[model samples]
Target: MKKITCPLRWILFLFCFPVVGSYVCAQDSVSVLFIGNSYTYVNDLPGTFGALAANLGKELTIDSKTNGGYTFQNHTTDPLTYSKIHSKPWDVVVIQGQSQEPSFPDVQVNTQTLPYAMQLSDSIWANNPCSNVMYYMTWGRQNGDSQWSEINTFEKMNTRLYHAYMRMADSSDRAMVSPVGRVWSYVRANYPLINLYNADESHPSLEGTYLAACTFYTSLFRESPSGSDYHPGIGAGEAWVLQNAAAAVILDSLDHFHLHPVDEPTQASFTLVQNGDTIQLTNTSSRATTYTWDFGDGQSAITEDAQHTFGGNGIYNVQLIASSSCNTDTFSIQVTTLGVHDHLFDGIKVKTSDEFIELTSSGGTFLIRTFSIDGKLLTEQSLSNKNPLMISRINQFQVLHLTDSGGFEKVIRIF
Candidate 1:
């Protein structure tokens, strides 16, 4: 039996096109610091990200200044906390208040606390310059926890806290909020078994820890390694996807690559006759825009899709910059050549607009003469003439060629 295959173009069209969504790439390694309470420390929360990054061929290190029950106030007063941010460089510092801070009615808990986190964030940025700070918005406590009794409702408290943190991040623009709390809500809506609490119903279980890892990974890295096929086990594919997603997310988030539309080809592939030695450029962007071509020659630029000839051999860089109102992009290529020596003074052609009739060479100078088939002198001129020198004006065209100052001739025209 024979196997059948789908066309590659169709496959590429389906998978390669950009969707409305955006993702951050984590190509480079990341140094992360988690600043929080047991919610962050218990069950080795930071290791999950490190483990996942490793799966994706990334080296991720998670260090922290954590206390078992530290709140935003504790972190502000803790000398050890300040020391960690300054000790070494960090890519991101994850900061959060006590999970119950949002449940308070005074709102000053969040208002006062966010500033301290931001202060720490600023210090980190001042030190690292390129580091990003993220606030981890934790989930609501168990349905009947004592912390919620005075908060009126767990749901309302979590929502307000989430929004408070979001507002703080938005105002500063120096921090990003990872929506793990939202994902936790999303998972709980579908899966009743996803609750983290043991029978005591206060803390999370192994399953709960895994869920937290997934939420953090997805929001922070823009992809969840577990995918839609999520289950309880922590094995091969799950681990690999999680780690790679972390690397991809972190890398992409930091380095931005602005792209211009690719020049449309006459076809997916093209062939050019070797003589003309020019590649015609086209605007393939959806909108019309101006283009500038730097044919990689250290020469002047041309504004049109004109033909060019190479004088010698080797690779040359060709660069093009195109711009639209929305964005601008650049493209470059190196044109390599087979360097064989030859002289065109023997039989070269020239049948272009008079404005483009200049000869360039690396050797001897050239003179030009025009004549009829009957040897009647039509026009004779100095080959070195660099002005508006007119040639034959006959209607019945024949052949004309170019000659060197030494009288060697090349057929410049055959018509």
Candidate 2:
């Protein structure tokens, strides 16, 4: 799939060519299957998410099976949802319950939402161990749930909904929550001009759906959708409002909503600068209080930041272990100590824009290798005679090691 650079053209393309079920089964694509009620279907939340992904130059496949006013229990009992989970490998399976179901009392939610959520999560993991079960925490009714006397206001309803979804996610190993409802609360409180509710005061209006799409994009991709061009026919002005609203809620505190999958722990990230045979490691890990450094040469240090000198290195694996009360993670980098042979690329210039890595030089064939911050090689390509080479989809936070045939090397970090 070629990248679409123009936002307007991309929006046109999305409307002209609506994605079908057949279009979503592609190799190496990020596949998400949404299973829920009308909340997941109205304004085509999955389709909106697809457009948002395209805007960000990501290959995404979205498919949803939704029925009006259906609960998670109904979805668990339905065979189609089960078959879809088993039919193909999905990167994410988003589950949304009926609007009022999660806001109900503890006894009701425990007996209703929790059991069905667990059942659905088990089915998803059984089908694909890698699939992440995301609970779509939906919003309270526009006027609040009249049936539930204990939750008479939107604030109370959303509060209950938040706790219920959090409990559900915390109970399971593979489950996480996408706090779309919380984003709605923020929008409603701050942006009064943007009406999220429809005439019924329950289902989302177009703006509401757009906000939901932005929240999903942030939750699933772990990237903010603040400047995405795909607006799904909504005016650019309104789209901007919703996008900012989504970012303010989702990106401000991602851990509050449990956006990341349970098995994926916090990452240990650091920057390294080499001078002669000594290397300096700067610890920049998040949510970690302690650090352990391993130079991979029988030498290690227990500090947040340290300097290590190699005996006489060809290539050594340097590892950092960052830990907190909740999680522990390790990051490794292969550092090549060339003694006096380390020369900077004098004429080479490297830069990044959006997803592409742009390399510029007067002339020469260069070996460009992309690697994770941990030093795992991602791609190796030789650019011959091409003064500028642009590599796409290098969007994650990582390091790029560029070496020319003349042995000059440059290391750049993308964060």
Candidate 3:
């Protein structure tokens, strides 16, 4: 007597599902929502990130809905997530999948992660045209994904994870990747003493969560967290280390994560001259309408050409960010300053032209050393009986160390 109908079945499904609360929109503040599973909730990433932002004097409204071991497919099918996405004018919506889902083979990723990511991104944009969808690129398991033969080693799994998240971000217009996994890779490789994983090797430890929070801070604010006062209950020393690590990997190269501010390409270039403790910055950028400069001494400027005075003598990493409506570029240089009376290398005159570094000394053998701003040595040479040694420009900017045979040394900035 009763005929089973497809429409009736769908209605029953909707009725049986649990109701998710509607997210209220906020005004005059940055608002973000996190959607994922245990990886996002274990250490309370959203809360920690909010605290970090607060410590930086920024107001961020943060929310999250996470379930244990839930995948993107689950989120796509869940009515609560759908309601949340469609209910608010969110500034950002962060999405992360099951830890193992992204490490699967390409076919599996296409069949599973890609489709769900596209759906979520579409929902985010459809609901709030100005909202940004950030895909949280999670790290591989501490040891590896043993359940799958294709992802047995950490390197293998991480490689696959990187490609998967990149693919997802590239496929959508409003999507960008957080590259939290890449940050983990950097920490593990460089800071082996810092353990990011818990005993289970999958969930993040407090330090790991702190790093993630720092990454989020940089991504959302488009500024480095190096000077933030928040430590999130961790020791100040360790917090500083984590903050710098995140900045070095994320803020230094936003393009690696496809997190540039705009879609059109732009370049950041600048030259600076130090007069005593005051430095004047000249912006030489292309295809840019806005400029932001971080003087690397807890000071920042927004003018096209800015001048800043330092209080002490030390090396500072100065960053210049140039942006257009759809794209951004970054350039950085290290500025070293000394007192007016200090002369380490007396008689060593340095001049820079468009293409070469012109150096003149008092007719003796001198050792020339060049280094990147990050303190990496790039070139080393000894000049003997040369009146004016001309070295081609190695990079946009570098530090040149000149040491005379008599043991006198001088450090100069080449721009």
TM-score of 3: 0.59
TM-score per prediction, in order, is 0.48, 0.59, 0.59
Tens digit per residue, CA lDDT, model 1, 81-171: 7787776677667787766664455456446566676677667666665456677777666563343454445466557666656655544
lDDT string for model 3 (244-350, tens) is: 88888888667546565523335677766554467777776644678999999999989999989989998899999988654677899878777553354445666
lDDT of all predictions? 0.51, 0.74, 0.75
Among these predicted structures, which one has the highest lDDT? 3
Give the count of colliding residue pairs in each prediction.
15, 1, 3
In candidate 3, residue 87 scores what lDDT?
58
Judge candidate 1 at residue 188 and give its lDDT: 58
Model 3 lDDT, residue 116, Cα: 88
Task: After superposing candidate 2 on the true structure, give the runs of residues whose Cα lies further than 4 Å from its correct spot.
Answer: 1-28, 261-415
TM-score head-to-head 2 vs 3, winner? 2
Pairs in clash, predicted candidate 3: 262-326, 262-327, 263-326
TM-score of 1: 0.48
